[model samples]
Target chain A: MKRRNLFIFAVLAALGSGPANAACSFSNEVPIKVLSAAFEAWKSVTDAMAECGNVQASLDQDFRLKQSAAFAANPALYQLGGVANNTIPQLLNEKRIRPLNDLVEKYGQHLKPNQLIKVGGDIVAIAMMVNTQEFAYRKDIFDELGLDVPKTYDQVFEAAEKIRQSGKVDYPLGGMTMSGWNMALEWLNVYASLAGDSFLNADGTPNFNNENGIKALELLKRASEYMDPEYLVSDSTFVQQQMQQGKIAMANIWASRAGAADNEAESKVVGKIYTAASPLAAEDARPVAMLFWDGIVIPRNISDEAAEAAFRVAMEGLDTEMVQAHNDDAVWLIEGYKPGRLAEGAVATASAQPSPISYPMTIEMGLIHSAIGNQISGFFTGAKSAEAALRAAEEEYGTAAREAGLLQ
Target chain B: MRFRTFAAFVAPSLLLMVLFIAAPLTSVFVQSFFVTQPQIQRVETERCTAGFLEQQCTTEIKNVPVLDENGAVVTTTRFVGLDNYRAVVRPDRAFAALSAWDWQALMSIDFWKALRFTLTFTLVTLPLVVGLGLAIALAVNNTMRSIRGPVIFVSLLPFIVTPVIGALSIRWLFVGDGILTRAMEAWSGTEIAMFAQGWTIELLMLFYRVWHVAPFAFVIFYAGLQTMNRETLEAAMVDGASRFERLRYVIVPHLMPLIVFVSLIHLMDAYRVFEEVVGFRSQAHVISLQWLTYDLLQPDDAGNRAVSRASASAMLTMIGIVILLVPLLRKSWRDHKGAR
Candidate 1:
C-alpha cells in the first residue's frame, strides 16, 4: 500500500522519456463475433490441412488444395485468385500487395502454370462478429403460441406480446440478452434504414434526433415488456444459459457465440439454434443487419517470395467453392462483406443473396454503431423515453465523430 | 574492465529494447511530425508459388488515393493533420463528419465526447476510491481476526475479475430490468438511470475501483495498526485524551505516511481507470493521461489525427504527470522525514 507515489511517477516518467509524444497503436478489438468464428473455422481448416505443422507450411498445403480446386473446377480463375494490386492501387502504393506479387513471380516459379491446386476448402472469410439470427428458439414455441416466424418488425411485437402472455417460459425470447453492443448493431439498422432519421444528415450533425429515431427506439422498447426479469442483469453469454437450459424461447445471437449457447456437444436442442436476419424495424420494415468483419491484411515486412506465397495461399482459401465443401457446409459464410474494387467483378458473383457482411470501409458505419450502443440499452432499461434516448444518442455519437475527425 | 563487463552484460537487454520497443516507439514519435507519409510504388511482377503472396508485400499505410484505370478511387488515404485535434475540440467540425452518409465518426463528436467523458469519469472516480479506501482501512484496523479474512477476500473480488468479464457484468447490471435496477425501482417507485445518466456512471466507476482496492487498504491499515505502539495510546488515554484527541494527535499522524502512500497508490491505480470506464460504458468519459500514453505507444488504428497526435498527447500527459505527481511525492517524502 505504501506505493512510492513520486518514485512510481518517476519510473513512468523515465520509461516514457525515450520518446516525445509518441502514440502506441495497441488495439484490442480484433474481428469478433461470427467474424472471429469464421477466422477460427479458417484456422481449423488450415491447421487440419497442414503438411509440416508450421503455419506457413499448412498455408502452403491448403493453398495448393484450393488453387487446384479452383483451376480444375473453374479453370478461368488464373490470376484472379492472387493479389489484385492491379485494381486496388493503394494495395501496391501502400505496399500491402507488393511482397505477394514478387513472391508469386519468384518463389512460385517452381509450380507449373498448367498445374492447379487441389481444393480441400481452405480459403474463406471465417471467425467474425456477423449478426446472423437467433440460436436456441423452439419452432414449437412459435407454433404453440400461434405465432409465425416474424418477417418484419410488425410481426415482431405481435409475437413478443403473444410470447409474454403464453408464459410457458420465464422469458419467451432470449439470446444475446444483455449485450448493449449487440443491441446497438440491431438498432443501427433501424436508425439508418427504418428510422426516418438517418445516422447522418445533409449537414452531417448526427441526426438521431429525427422522428424516425424515436420511432425506432419506441418500437425496440416494445420488446422490453417481455424480456427476462434479469435480462439486463446477465450478459449475452450468461443469458444464453437461460436459453440453452430451455428457460427462454428465442434470442438474436451471433453465429459464433451460438456454439456456446447450447454447448454443442451436450445440447438437448442440438441443431436447434437457427441463423436468421436481424429483426425488422417495424412489422412492415425491410430487414436490415449490421455487418461483422474480419479483415486480413498482411504486414509489410516479409520478403517478396514469401508475401506472394502467402497471398496465393490466402487466395486459395477465399474460394467459395472450397468453402462450400467444408464438413460444415452451412458454416462456410460469404454473405455480407464486399471486397475492394480489385475483385468487384468476381465478388459480385459471390455477393448474391446470402453473404457474410463485413466492414463497409465507410465512416457512417462507425457512427451508426456508436448511436446504437448508446440508445438500445437505454430503451430496454427504460432510463429515458425512446425519443429522449435517441436524441441523446445523436448528440453523443455526433460528438464522438467530431473528435475522431470523420465529420468534416 | 568493469565498464566493459557491465556493457557486455547490459547489451542484450538494451539491444532488444532498442529493436522491439525503442525503435517502434521512436518511429511512432517521429511519424507524428509528418503530415504526409511517403508512398511505395507498385511494379508488375511474375507470380511465385504460382499465387501465394499479395497483401504481405504491401502495407496498409497510404497518404493519397490510388486511382484505377478509369480514375475512380481504388484506395483513398488522405493526410489531415491537426484537423483531428481541432475537430475534437471544435464541435462544429466534428458535427460535419457526423453528416457522413454513414453513421460512423468521420472526424468529430465520438472521439471528443469519448475523450471528454473519459477524462471526467477518471477524475471523479479517483477520489471515491481513495475515500472509501480510507474508510475500509479504518474498519479493518479494528476488525476481529475471524471476520477480517472473509472481509478482505470479498473486498478483493473486483481485482480478481478480468476487465472483459467485469465490463460485461457491469453492462448486465446497468442494462434494463437488472436486479439492482428493479430493486431500486421498487424502493423509489421511480426509475434510476445508472448507465445512461452521466452522474450514475461516475458512481459506478467509483464502486468498481473502491471495491477492487478496499482489500489492499484493509491489509495495509491492519498491518499498520498491528505495528502501532500501545504504550503511547495508553499514555494518551491515561492523560484523559478524548477519542478525537487520540485519533487526531496520534492515529492521524501515524497514518499520514501510510495514507499518502496508499493514496498515491490508489490514485495511480484510479487514474488508469480504463477498465471501470469501459466496463460501465459511462457516457461521460475522461481517460487518464496514463491510458492515453499507453495507447499512444502503439500504432494508430483509427488513421485519424487524434491517433496520430496521440504521441504528442502522450508526451503532454507524461509531462503533466511529472508536474502533478512530483509535488505529491515531495509531500510524501516530507511525511517520511528524518528517516536517515
Candidate 2:
C-alpha cells in the first residue's frame, strides 16, 4: 500500500508540471532576458512569455533611461527591449537594435501587417498596442448636472464652469499636468491641435514661438483655473486615482488607465465613468492628443541564436491567447482583441477625421521636447509670460540643437 | 607612530580617494572645457505605425546620427573653452536683467533661480537647526534620568529615518487634503493647499530640514554639555548670577565649538539640497544647484545628455560651496593656530 502511494504521488507531480509546459508550444532552451516599462500590458505580455521558461524580465518605469546603454554593451544585457515611438530613435540612431525583417520572415508569420513598425523600409520593431489620451468623465455626474460631453476647448471650459457652479465634485476638472514630461505632452497635445504647421523648421530650428504657441499656452492657463490648484504636480496615476475616488468629475487621461475606472476592487465609481474622444483645441482640428505605440525590439549586440529565441518568445507573448486574456488592459493590436467599453475612447480618438499625428520619432524632436518640458512650467507658475516662456523654450532648443550639431 | 606604519595605515584609503574622487574631479574638469557631439544628417524617411484599422505612413525629414561602417555613431569632440559655462550661466541675459533691475527676468534663468533658492535654504535653515538643537539638548538634559532615554530616542526618530523617506512622509502629511492639511483646514475654517505656491513649499522644505537634521546637532551638543565645566557653572550661580545669565555666558560659550562644527556640516549638506525638491515635486516652482547639474546630465529620450554643460555646472556648484565656506574655514584656522 505504501509503495502504491509513492507511485501515485510521483505521477501526480509529473501531471502537475505537464499543463504548464503544454501552454507553450515549445520549451525554450536558450536563456532570454527582457527589459521593458512596467505597465499592465507589459505585465500580461511578459507573463505570457515566461511560460516558455528561461525568461527573466526586468520591468521598470525608467526603462528608457537604461535601454540605450544596456543594448550598446557587447553581448547585450537584455536580448529583448520594449520601446515606444519616442524612445526608439535613440536605439535606432546608435544602431543598438537589430532590423527585424529577417526575424519576421522566419518566426513572425502570425503578426498583423499593421503591427510592424517600419522605418525607412526596414521593419525594426513589433508593435503590440496603441495608446492615446482621451476624455474620461463621470456619466452620472454629467447626467445629474444636465451637461453635455465637451467637444471643443470652448465647450470644455463651459462645462468646467458649469460643474464648478454646481459643486458636483471636489474639483471640476483634472489633468496630467505634472512637471517635466507630462506637462510637455499636455502642451504639445494642444499645440498640435491648434497649429497648422510643423513643430520644427526644415533646418531643425524651433517653429513654436508663433501665435499658435501663445494660444495654446493661454488656453492651458484658462483651463487651469477650473482644475485643482495643485495640478502642476499631478501625473496620470494621480489623475486616475482622483477619478477612481470620485474626487474629480473629468480628465483627459491615458487610454491604458481607462480600465481602472471600472475596476470594482479599487474604484468607488465603477460603471459610472465613460470615455470619449479627446476634446478638440478648435472646431475643425483633430483630437488634441498624440498617438503612441509600445513595441518590442531585439538588440544588435546579441548573438543570432539568442535573438531568434527572444523573438520566438516575444511572438508567443504577443499571440492571440494573451490578447484574449488581457483585451481590456490596452487597445491591443492583436487579432483576438475585442474593443470593449474601456477601449471605446482610444478607438474613437484614433478614427477621428483628420486623425491626430503620432508623436514624432526623431532626434531633434527629443531635444525640443526636453526644452519645452524645462521651460513651459514658468508660464503656469506665473513667473514668466506665455511669450517669454515660448522664447525661452526656443532659445533653449537652439542651444541644445547647436550642441547636438543639428544647427550652426 | 613610525613613518612606515603611518604610510601603511593611510595607503588603502589614499588609493581609494584618488580613484573615486580626485580622478573623477579631474576628468569632469577636463570635460567641462570640451564638447562632444554626434554628426547629425537630415534624411527623408518613411515611417509606418498602426492606426485603428490600417497602417498610417508618413514621409518626413528626420535628423539621424551618421554611423560609421562599424555601426557606431560618428562623433566629433572639440575644445570649446567656456562655451558650456556661458550656456549654463547665460551671463548676457543675466546682466541684461540685472541692469534693468528686473528680478523676474533674472529668476527666469535656471542657474540664478537655483542659486537663489539654495543660498536662502542654506542660510535660513542654519540658525533654526542650531537653535532648536540646543533647545532640545537642554530640555532633555533637564529631564529626569529614567525618562531621558525615551525622550532622546523619540527626538532622534526623524533623523533616524532616511532623508528621502522623511521628506516624502512630511510631503504626504501636508500635500493636498492630507491628514494634517485637513486638520488645519478644520482649525482655520478655510481650505488649505500647501503645495499650491512656491513660498509655502519652500517653508515646508525648510521646516523638514530642521526637523530631520536637528537631532544630529542635538547629539553633538549634548555630548559637549556632558563635558561642561561644572565648577564654572557653580561659581557663576554662587555669585548670584541669574539662570538665564549663566546659560547665556557659560553654557553657550562651552558649546560654541560644537555650534561652528554643526554649522559647517549643515551648510555643506543643505547647499546640495536635492531630496526636498524631488520629494516636494517643486520643480515647477523651485530648484537647487545640484538638481540643475543632475537635470543637465540626465539624458533625454533620444539619449542626448549635456555632458559639457553638466560638468561646468557641477564645477560651479563646487566653487560656490568653497566660497560659502571661506569665512568659517578662516575662523577655524585661527582657532587652530591659537590652540597651537
Candidate 3:
C-alpha cells in the first residue's frame, strides 16, 4: 500500500508541472495579415485611450501577448527597459543587447531595432526616432501680440518680448522650469548650441565646465528674467496649455505633446500659432530632440522558435492599420514629423517616405543631456554662479557616470 | 512536552516574521551600505576655455572612492553611532552638504525652521484625528437605527480616497486661481501660498489626515464604544450629572486606551508625508523629512550607495519619534494602570 502511494505521488508531481511549461510553449507565429489586423485594433484603442503610452501599462493581456510572441521569435531583436530617473540601470543593462548586436549583423537587410523603437514601441511597426511637427496660435492671441507667425527662435523671442512689454498678458513666458527634468531639456538645447560639439566627447564624456557650457548657463540665466518663480515646479504639459490659450508668450514644447496644448474649439490663438526651433546660445548648434519611447522586451527564458515568432508578431503589430492610425492621430504629429507612418491616414502607406533618426539606447547622448538640465536649473535659480555651478556639475556628473559603472 | 508545544507555536510566527518582514528590511538596509559593480560614473571634469587655464580654470575632479573616517573603504551602512545624530546637531553636516540642487533651499533659514512648525502640527493634529474619530464613533453608537449605516459610511469617506486625489480636490477647492481664490482676493485682499505657508500646509494636512484616518479610528473606537454599558451612563445621568459631567465622568474614562492606540499609529504615518507635497509646492520649498530621505535614495550621477546617509537619517528619525512619544506613552499607560 505504501509503495502504491509513492508511485501515485510521482505521477502527480509530473502532471502538476505541465501548466507552467504549456504557457511558455504557446505559438506566436500568426501570419502578417493577422498581424496587420491586430495593428489596426491596437491603433484604434491607442487613439481612443489618448493618454496611455504603453498598452502593457493600461492593457496588460495584449501587451503580454505581444511581448511573449516577440520573445518566442527573436527575443534579442525587440525589448527596451529602463526606470524613470533611473538611467543608470538602463545603461548597465545595455550588456544584455549583445545577442541583439549579432542578430542585427545577420538581419541587416530588414530593420534596425534601435531606430524602430525611436518612433513607437508597438509590435508591428519599426519605431522611428525623428518625431516632430509644428503648431500654431489661435486668432485672438495672434492679434493681441501683434505678432505674425515667427519662423526662428529669434523671431519667437522677439514676438514674446514685444507681447510682454506691451503689458497684454500676466505671464510673459509659459514653459516648465520644475523638477529640473523639463528645465534639464531646455538646458540641453542651450548647451548643445553654445558648447557646440565639444560638450560631448566621442565616448560620451561631457565638456561641461568648458567656455561653451558657461555660455549656455549665461543664456539660461538671461531667460530667467521672464519666467515666473512658480515655473520651476509647474507641470510641463499644463504650462504649455496656458501658453496655447495666450496665457504666456511662447513655449518650446514636444511635437507629440502639442495636442493637449492646442485649443481648437476655444483657443483664440489657434491658427496663428507656429512651432519654432528651440534655439541655441551658439549659432552653429541645431535644435536638439530625442524620442520618448517604450518597447516590448522578451524575458530570457523562452525557446528560440517562440522568440522569433514573437518578434515577428510584435513588428507586425507595429505595421498594422489600427496601430498606425492611433500613432498618427494621437502619438505622432504626422505632418511636420513622420515616425512609422507608411499610410497617410494611420497605417504607414506603402509609398510613405522612410523615417530618419535613430532610437533605443544612446548612452553617449544621454550622458550629455543629463548634465545640461541640472546645471541649467542651477543657473536660472542662481543657486550658484554660472561658472561655479557648471564646474561642480561637470565633476558631479562625470563621477556619477563612472561610479554607476557605465564609464570605464 | 509543554516546552515543545510552546516552541512549535512560536516557531512558525518567528520564522514568518524573520522571512517576510525582517529579511527584506535587513536586505534593503544592508544594500544602502554596499556599492556593487556595473555602476557607471558620469563625467565630473570639463576642460578650461582658452586663457582661463591661467588660474583655477581646471582642477582634477575628485572621484575618490567613498571612505570612512579612518580613510577605509566604507561600503555598507553600519551603525555609525551618533555620527548621524550629530548631523542634526551640526548645521554644516546637515542635508545641505550632500545636495547642490537643494542648495537653493538653504537661502531661507526655514529649512530648519519647518521642524518647530512640524512638531507643533504633530502635537495638534494627532489628538484631533483621534478625538474626532472617537466622537464620531460615540455618535454613531447612539444614533437612530435608520441612519447608522449612512452615518458610519459618511464618516469614512476621507480614508478611502487616494490621498493624492483627495489633496488635489482640496487644492482645486482652495487654490488662488479657483473661485475661492478670486473671492478671497476680492474680500481679503491677500495673496496666499498654500504650500509655502506653514499654516496652510498644516490645515491641508489636518483636513486630509482627518479624512483618511477617521474611518479606521472610528471603526476601532466604535467597536470599543459598543461595549460601553448603558447602565453606567444612566447611573451618571440619574446622579444629577449634566451632559458635560456625564461625558467627562463616564465616556472619557472609557475611551482613553483607544485614543493612545490611534495617536501612536497616526504619528508614525504622518511622519512619512511625501506624495501630496510634491504634487503641490509652487513657490517656496517646504522641505520635509521624507523629501530629504528620497534625495538620498534617488539615483545620482555617481550611482554610489547612499546607504550610510539613509540609514543614519532613518535611525535619527526613529529616535526623534521615540523621544517625542515617550511622555505621551507614559502618561497614557499610567492613566490605564491607575484606572484598572
Top model number, TM-score: 2
Q: In lDDT terms, how accurate is model 2?
A: 0.90
Second chain only: TM-score per model? 0.65, 0.97, 0.72
Distance from true location, Cα of B276 in model 2, Å: 0.2
- What is the Cα-based TM-score of model 1? 0.58
Interface RMSD of every predicted model, in angstroms: 12.6, 1.1, 14.4
- Scoring only chain A, what TM-score does candidate 1 earn? 0.61
lDDT of 1 by residue, A1-408 (tens): 235434433443443222211221121111110011223444543322221111221223123223322322221122222211111222323223222334434433433331221111111111211223332356667767776766556666677778878777767666343434456655564554464324566555776666777776665555655665444434566655666666777765544445554356655665454444455555444444433323233334434343444444443444443344432322333322332221221222123233222222333444455455644564564444566566657655664454443444
The TM-score, computed over Cα atoms with residue i paired to residue i, of candidate 3 is 0.64
Every model's TM-score: 0.58, 0.96, 0.64
- The DockQ value obtained for model 2 is 0.80
Clashes of each: 139, 0, 83
Candidates' C-alpha lDDT: 0.47, 0.90, 0.48
| Tens-digit lDDT track of model 2 for A1-408 | 667545533543442322223467887878788999999899888878877766767889899999998998999999999999989989988989888999999999888999999988899999999999889999998999889999898998999888888988989889999988889888899998876337897666798888889888898888888888998999898899999999999888899988999999999999999999999999998898888999999999999999999999999989998899888999999998898887788888888887888887888878888999999999999999999999999999999889998899
- Candidate 3 CAPRI grade: incorrect
Please name the candidate that would achieve the greatest DockQ relative to the true structure: 2
lDDT of 3 at A93: 29
Question: Which scores higher on lDDT, 1 or 3?
Answer: 3
| Model 3 Cα lDDT, one tens digit per residue, B189-229 | 87644543445655776676667777888988998878888
